[model samples]
Target: CWLQQALRATDNPVIDAAVRLGNVLGLPVLVYHGVREDYPYASDRLHHFILGASRDLAAGCRARGLACVQHVDRSGHRERGLVYRLGADAAALVLEDQPTFVARWQTERVAERIEIPVYAVNGACLVPPAVLGEGIGGRSGFLRRHEPGRAAWTVADDESTDIAPYDGTLPFVPDTLEGDLDALIAELDIDHSLPASAAFPAGRAAAETRLMRLIQDVLPGYATTRNDATRREGASGLSPYLHFGVLGPREVMRAVEKAAVGARHSIKFADELLGWREWFHYQARALAKPEQYDRVAGWARATLADHAGDPRSHLESLTAMLRGETRDESWNACQRQFLRFGWMHNNLRMYWGKRIIAMTPDPETAWATACYLNDRLSLDGRDPATYGNIAAMFGGSPGDTDRPVYGRLATRSDGSTRSRDGGAAWLAKAAS
Candidate 1:
């Protein structure tokens, strides 16, 4: 099994499918995961989290009686076409069906170039898109189909193999990630300044902690506190882990279902986590290139173009915006969360994304800047949810009011957060 993003060992559809295939074929399953420095937004922050998760993935695979190999692409450890080379030695190739960002691009390129008969598995969604079937045009139609299938997919698919782990590997040497991950990442040719998150640590243990926090702390008052943005316990910090595939939605949902929270809170959390997030995933799969600005609503694009030349003030440079030094204090708070912790509250993201329309020269620049800052800084960046939410911020439902810069595009504020108790102080401290 060649893993691109689905890094977990158990409760992983990608890994489980590979094991099932290996068992049926009467051959040991060999799992391979590699990191390239040239991947989009390669930095200390991304690399640290990835490598740490990868290390645990290897350990988890070993505990499951599977041999998992890894390679970290650096100055001394560069390997060209590793996936293709490994595919040559295997019976058949199995990979994660990533729908967005770099992994999707890489998976497509591999399927085109490799001579082997390859199979792709949906490792991200609770209900695999293929099983959701074809000819669904919109979200309502999707929900009509998707909601019925949720209960069936909630069960874990932990497939076991009688065959032993594959030991015979003829490809290049694998990197032993047993010690000094920070030192190893430091030597890579990636952006070293953006450090790993202190708030969200890497590995399966950290993922478990976040899951517990979701159930014990976040879920009980989720409906009431989800949009406050002032309390740390308001939102579950599981996006980073989910984005990296350290914690699969199945496992996360399972935890949520069993939590001792009110029905309202439970339903609200489920809507946000499973309902909305999976909807974005489904929407992304339908598009040719979900990351492109063209994927945003056509009406939003037209309105934004009509007001593209509106006079804007307090223009923040890309550097200023990136470093969280923007003139907008509320935006600074939002950006700082992404910078320091590789995350931003959903409430603040609306304000930050909408404000960027006036902060930049044009709507196109605003879209680019929002995506760039997000994909570069946030851990959950480049995801279906990220792009989907950003697009919503730009387009939304066409407003009756026509305004400067925004035109018919909906605008937002930090009132949900700033109007609350100690909220202004929270923003000031967050920006600082």
Candidate 2:
């Protein structure tokens, strides 16, 4: 099994499917995860998180009796077409069914080249998009079809193989992640300017910590405080882990269901995780390029184009926006989170994204800038939610009134957060 995004060993459909296939074929599953320096937005932040997760994935695979191998593409260890070489040694390849970004691209390329039967398992979602069928309109229809299917997918698929782990890996030597990861990352040719996210530590242990915290602190007031942005406990801060497949939706929902919390709160959390997150995933799978500017709503794109050249004072440079040094205090407050932690509050992300339409020279540049900054700085960037949320910002239901720079798109403020008892102070502290 070639894993690009589905990093977890437990509760991973991709891994389970591979194991089941291995058992059926009487062949041991060889799990291969490789890191390339050339992938889009390869930075210290992504590499640190991925490598740490990879380390635990290996350990977890060992505990589950599966052979997991890894390779880091660096100056001293550059193996070209490693996936093809690995594929030649295997009977068939089972890999992640990611709908967007590098994972989707790689999977398509590898599937085209390999002669063996390639199975793409939807590990990123609780209910796979393929199961939902196609041409589902909007979130409500998605939920109507999606909610019924949730219970069936709730069970974890940790299939065990009777055969021993693959010991005969005849490819190149695999890199050991047990060594100093930071030092190893330094050796790679990725963005060093963007430092590792200190706020979100990588690995299964950190992910588990976040999950436990969600049960204890976050879930209790999640429904009320999730939009506040002032309270640290308002959000679970689990997106990085989720994006990297450090935590699957099934495992997360499993913990959430068992939590001794109110149904309303838990339901709200579930809606966000299962309903909205999966909807975006489904939407991305239907699109040729979900990250593109063209994905913005047709009316919203036209409205934005109408007002594309109308912006005056609010326009800011890419450097200023990138550094969170813009005149807009609320926008900067939202951006500083991305700058420092490589994550931002969901509520703030909406405002940050919308404000970019006015901040940039035109709608296209605004779209590109929003995606570039988010994908480059934030750990949760380049995700389905990232593009989906930004698209909503650019093209929300056409407002009754049109405005400067934004046109028919509705505007948002930090007031919801600021009006909170401690929100103003929180925003002040976050922005500084």
Give the count of colliding residue pairs in each prediction: 0, 0
lDDT of 1 by residue, 147-212 (tens): 899999998758997787788955899997998999999899999989999999999999999999
lDDT of 1 at 137: 69
Evaluate residue 36 in candidate 2 and report its C-alpha lDDT on the 0 to 100 scale. 98
List, residue by residue over 300-358, the lDDT tens digit for candidate 2.
Answer: 99988898779468889888998889998889899999999999989888888888887
Q: At residue 253, what lDDT does model 2 achieve?
A: 94
lDDT at 124 for candidate 1?
Answer: 90
Query: What lDDT does the true structure give each of the candidates?
Result: 0.90, 0.91
Q: Ten residues in a row with the worst lDDT in model 1?
A: 161-170
**TM-score to true structure, per model:** 0.98, 0.99
